[model samples]
Target chain A: MKVAILGMGSVGKGVASVLSSKDLGVMVTGVADSRSGLIDPDGINIGALLATKRSTGLCGSAGITAMDVVRGAPYDILIEVTPTDAVSGEPALTHIRTALTMGRHVVTSNKGPIVHALHALRSLAASKGTSIRYEATVAGAIPIMHTLADGLAGNEVLALYGVLNGTCNYILTRMAAEGLTYEQALLEAREMGYAEADPTYDVKGIDAAIKLVILANTIWGTSSCLKDVEVRGIDLVTLDALQLAEDQGCTIRLIAEADPSNRILRVSPRILRSRHPLVTEGTLNAITLVTDLAGEITLMGKGAGSVETASAIIGDLLAIRSRYGRCD
Target chain B: MKLEMRDAPGQLVAALKPISDLGGNIIAVIHQRDPGSRSEVLGVQIVLDLPQDRLSDLTDLIRSQGVNILRVNEERLLCTRAVIMIGHLIHTDLGGTVDAIDRTGFAEVTGLTIRMPAIDQRSSARFTIRSVNREHMEDAIAILRTVAREKGLLMIEPMGVSQ
Candidate 1:
């Protein structure tokens, strides 16, 4: 299958590297970074492009653009691994819509478009007789979307709880294990490259809220958005509070939850028993879905990373290929 | 127990004094008043819990006060959930915060433990809220959520397996 990948960022590079290294029956025909774009009808040399990007950070000419690849490329799938806008769902939204309208499959690791324009995008894909698969939009490498869509297809979902933000989890874990203050733990996380320079999105619970909205909409078509979640951050979590929780054999974690029947969509720091499945340590994500037939299902894996997120995009691409047959 | 009494002053009070006298915990006292009506009798329903052996004695004592017993209903609190609240407890009127739930009568904060780290730093408290059942517990939690928002407190609620 041929794919045109956008955003040449960590995730894009990871996907390119994997496709080049393995015989996955996948080819990269077009690639783009924020500044440049590449297109070749005979499939691009992903290994050479990755090396060039490592050295010069431009995949193609500045004259060409991501939209050029999205609209003009001769590819079977548009792989969108762009950085999330969280609000506008912007350029990614346009790219996704244009591809779906042209009857091409879309596999994205972008959360913004999925959270904001999920239903509209799905309608476009259905109308065009193509699939828009976003397995990489939620928990990284966890296969959560696939599990909900296929594995637990017949079960009724009662509720969901997840530790969705790795930065917050890392900071909270450091604070609990070492008794570090919030500031100290956050500083450590930043130094370790787990947190961004502006950690507000992850620390303030917005990132998790976005993921929760995607999960809720995908599972139950709840039509929820970011604002619908009653969000509370880990900024106020104190050492004393952690100690207090420790006194009772419990710990604190930032949990994104959705209990639609009870009308609850909240992302907040919650107290959980230490032995609970959702109480995963340091930069890992865990989700527990309460189902009627299965009772409760818990899945845990790396929440964010270059290669980890690439696994999800690759999985979606493979799923699309298997269902619709290979793209020449 | 439902009681019928004269609309005369102090008759309602006279009817309720026995539950306290017999060491019963009054849960709810539901009554309706219509001053525009000139009815001679007032009906009141009281929900309370007490030792099983003390039930007959409490009923006898209420009747002795000239309050006619109409109907009796019994219910027990069946759920308890503990939540941790972190904020300036004293500044927010902790008593009032607790009273908000207790005032509902169907739920109460049965236990509380506070840890004050310093004079100005935030304090943390764990409140064990008990309710008649899961439904009432949810309502009590909603009330506490509102109270937490009003008082600038971060309430960390328990996360059950099924939410």
Candidate 2:
């Protein structure tokens, strides 16, 4: 199977490496970035890219722009791993839209396009008779998207909520368990590479808001844009605040949530003491999909990283390959 | 100086009574139900435009009422600009991203729009940004770029920095 990676960053490189594994039956044909990329439709040497990346924290190899990758010889799947911006996920949007238009299936870890352009993209995919699978968008490798889209297809998801952002969840979990101040915990998270240097989105709850938009829209056939939802961040979550909430039998978890009935989605630091299955927290993403028949389906696991997320993209690609590869 | 009083039962009224009794005009009261959880605390981003001469008095009065002052600083929200970002937007924490932009004290994500197909893909968003100074908008964009990199997002600045 031919595969192309749209971004050469951590996740993009990770996907390339995973798909290169002989067992996966995938051959990475090209790797692109905002800058140009390297392509070998015959199959690029992903092992070489990984060895270089590990030794030197930079990509010095030939690169291709997203346009080049999409325009090149078709691939069985394209992994759009471009970086995400809070406002416009342009290049990735351009990459996915183009790939869909070109009749190529796309599997991405980019949340920007999924959170902001799901319907249009899906409609485009339908028009092109192509599929866009993004199992790694929410809950990382936990398969939440598949569970809702396939496993629980019979159930009508009433609401879905969880600790969607590992950075915030790590910070909040540290603050809750180790009794660190929000600042102290956030500092630790940054030092450990769990939180970004800027750390604003993780601390404030906007990252979770984006995830909630995706979750809500996926469960319910609605747009659920970020503007429609209410967002409160954890930046205001003082030690005193967390302590007070804990005193009230609650643990503060940075939660991204959507209520299907109200058609509303929200993200913020939530004090959960409901003794529910999803209340436990840490560097884990746990989601509770409330449904009419299944009642509630909860999934929890590592929600980020190259290996975990890449594994998900690979899994989706393989599944798609098994069902649709021979046809195209 | 100003304080953030918990929006508990009679908390605002209680805090206000003290401010009024102490001769404070309660210059501006900004209150809104927290959109995330209704059962949770309501968020109030109030700005008390007190007379400079009476600022200290108002601060002390509000403090005495046990209303915690969340933030006390200069008042400014002029000259806003809009920006758009693309990629893993929500998962990257759009609220935190906006808050980070706002932390510069010059800009904030006043409005946001997002669309997600599923959990594990690039998400797109449009952010209406507002800043105090015109130049601060650039600083806000820089901060957004840094955030976008960490969140595995591809930021689409309105200025259109080509990839």
Candidate 3:
């Protein structure tokens, strides 16, 4: 399958590296970063592309933009790994819409488009005989979406509980394991590159809430958005609260939960037992899917990383290829 | 076929005689004897390989023997492949990986064998997967490849053969 990747950031570079390193029967025909774009119908040289990005902080030559890649690039799959803007769901949403409407399958890691316009995008994909897969949006590399759509097929998903935010989980884990205060844990998380500089989304629980919205919509077909989720961050989870929970043989974790049967979706710092499956350490994500047939199935994996998120995008790419081989 | 039979002497043997008498080969028999149950009935799930013409005869013979057949389901797994995966299989949660494939109704990991030399070293497993058909088998393998890539494992798939 021929793929065009937008947003040549960490995850985009990871996808390009995987495509170049592995013989997964996929070729990168076009690539676009924020500033420039490159197009080669035969197939772009990914090694050279990476070198160019490393030396000059850009993907391609002058006068080439993302619009050119989206409108004129020759490819079958459009991989949108751009950073998300939960408020607007812009540029990424437009890119995905263009691809799906043009009869090209879309695999994205951006949560904005999915959280904002899921039904509209899905309708367009269906009408155009294409698909939009975003396994990397929720829990990176967990295959939660695939499990819901295919593995747990023919079963009703009763509820879903997950440690959807890696930054909060890491901070909370440090506080629980090493007895650090919330501020101290947050600083350590930032130092370790687990938490972003602003850290507002990660610490304020908006990230987890957005992920919950995506999961709720994907699994239960609910028209949920960021506003629908009852959000509570770990910013106010004091050390005393952590100690109190520890005294009761539990640790505080930022849990994102969706109960479709009762129409409940929330993300908050909840006290779970120290040895709970969802109580994972470091930058790891865990999700427990409560289904009728499979019972309670928990999947744990690296929540965020270049290659890890790339693994999910590649999985979606392979799924598209397997379902509809090389549309071109 | 799942049947409920009286928990009495010779009840087990009596259930098999009809299948054998109608030229059916018994592949497996899962007999569950619940001692705490109030009813004096045992559940028996028998996997049989037989011609379609003999199914009616077998069911009729079993019914005549007073065995209550609860359910009958066709075995859909007709294609199988054995693959060997190597790396930190245990640390990466091999059970979760296997469950991802097995939970798919069209494919299942029917058998598994693992080998580990040390606690910190790499491990390997030979997995026998059965699917509804060749297409399903391919899909199962594709899922395995995705899991293997995510977990940093090496998967050696079978070539041009089905077990």
Candidate 4:
């Protein structure tokens, strides 16, 4: 399968590196970073593009643009792994829309478009006889979308609870394990590169809420807006709170939950037992989905990282390839 | 519950009928007829499982059946949820917060443990709220949420069904 990947950040590089190493009958015909774009009718040299990206910080010719690659590249799938703009399903949304309108399959790790234009995008993909798969938009490496859509195909999901934010989880883990104050732990997270400079999106619970919106929309087919989520950040959580939770063999975690039956969509700091399945440590993410046939199943893994996110995106690609079958 | 009904043959049937009418399950009924012990009344001990809300209705129906109820032990407020509130607890009128649930009749804040780092700093408290059933518990938490919002407090409810 020929694929075009946008966003040559860590995720893009990881995908390129993996495809270069694995002879999985996949070819990268096009790639684009923020500043440059590359296209080749045959397969692009993954090693050369990565080396140029590493040395010069530009993935390809600056004369080319992202839409140029999206519209002009000859590929079976468009991998839209751009940066997320939760407020506006950004340039990625337009890119995905254009690709689907062109009757091309899409695989993306972008949450902005997924959160804003999922219903519309899915309908457009269906109308064009193509589909968009976004496994990396939620928990980074959990393969949650495939698990819900394929592995547990017939089971009805009753409810979902997740620790979807890695930065907050890291802060909380450090706070509880080392008795660091919220501020101190947040600083530690920033130093360790787990948290961004602003950290508002992660610590303020907006990031997790966005991922929850994506998961909820996919599983229940409910076009839930981000505003529908009742979000609470961990910014105000104090040492005393964690201490009190630990007093009773429990800890605090920023939890995102969706219960369609209860009409609940929430992301907040919740008291969880220390041994609970959702009480994941460090930058790990965990999701517990309650289903009728399978009961409750918890999936946990790296929520964010180069290879971790690439794993989710590649899974989506392979799923589309398998469903449609190999052409070569 | 233990009951004293007249030793009439059909009196026992009258009392037992109301138990099932209220959608109660009769787990066991120790109605032993001591051949020589009963002077004029039959002392029968009955155990049953029923919704706590219908305890009053069951008591009323059994009394109208001419059975004197000596003792009734129905556990009310059997369901409890623990929530943590972190904010200016005292400044926000913590008494009002607890009173909000306690006044609901069905739900009450039964336990509390506070950790005040300093007088000027914010305080954190874990409150155990008890209610009769799941619906009542939900209502109680909703009230706390409203109160927490008004007080500018962060209310952290327990997650998972195990709590």
Instruction: Give the best candidate by TM-score.
Output: 4
Question: lDDT per residue, candidate 3, A13-103, as tens digits?
Answer: 9999999999998888889988889999999999999999999999996689887898898889999999998999989999999988899
Error of 1 at A24 (Å): 0.4
Chain B TM-scores across candidates: 0.54, 0.48, 0.55, 0.63
Q: What is the TM-score of chain B in candidate 2?
A: 0.48
Q: What is the interface RMSD of each candidate, in Å?
A: 1.0, 15.4, 20.5, 0.5
Q: Which ten residues in a row have the lowest lDDT in candidate 4 chain B?
A: B154-163
Cα lDDT computed for each candidate against the true fold: 0.90, 0.72, 0.86, 0.91
Off by over 4 Å in 3: B1-163
Give candidate 4's fnat, 2 decimals. 0.79
Candidate 2 vs candidate 4: which has greater TM-score?
Answer: 4
Task: Provide the lDDT at A316 for model 4.
Answer: 88
Candidate 3 C-alpha RMSD relative to the actual structure: 18.1
Separate DockQ for every predicted complex: 0.42, 0.01, 0.01, 0.68
Cα deviation of A150, candidate 3, in Å? 1.1
lDDT of 4 by residue, A7-35 (tens): 99888888889899988889999999899
lDDT of 4 by residue, B107-142 (tens): 999899999989999999999988977777888888
Query: Backbone clashes per model, in order?
Result: 0, 66, 0, 0
**Ranking under TM-score, best-scoring first?**
4, 1, 3, 2
Model 4's CAPRI class is medium
Top candidate, metric DockQ: 4
Give me the iRMSD of candidate 4, please.
0.5
lDDT of 3 by residue, B1-163 (tens): 9999998998888889988888877889998876778888889999987666678788888888889989988766868776666678899998898998989988899988776757986665767799877878978987997998799775655433321
Q: Residue by residue across A1-328, what tens digits does model 1's lDDT show?
A: 8899998898999999989988998888898889999999888998789889889979988898999999888999999988989879988999999999999999999999999899999999999989999988888999998899899999999889999999999999999999999999999999999999999999999999999999999889878898899999999888888887888889999999999887889999988999999999999999999999999999999998899999999999999998999877
Itemize residue pairs with steric clashes in candidate 4.
Answer: none
lDDT of 2 by residue, A179-216 (tens): 89778998998888898878887777778888888777
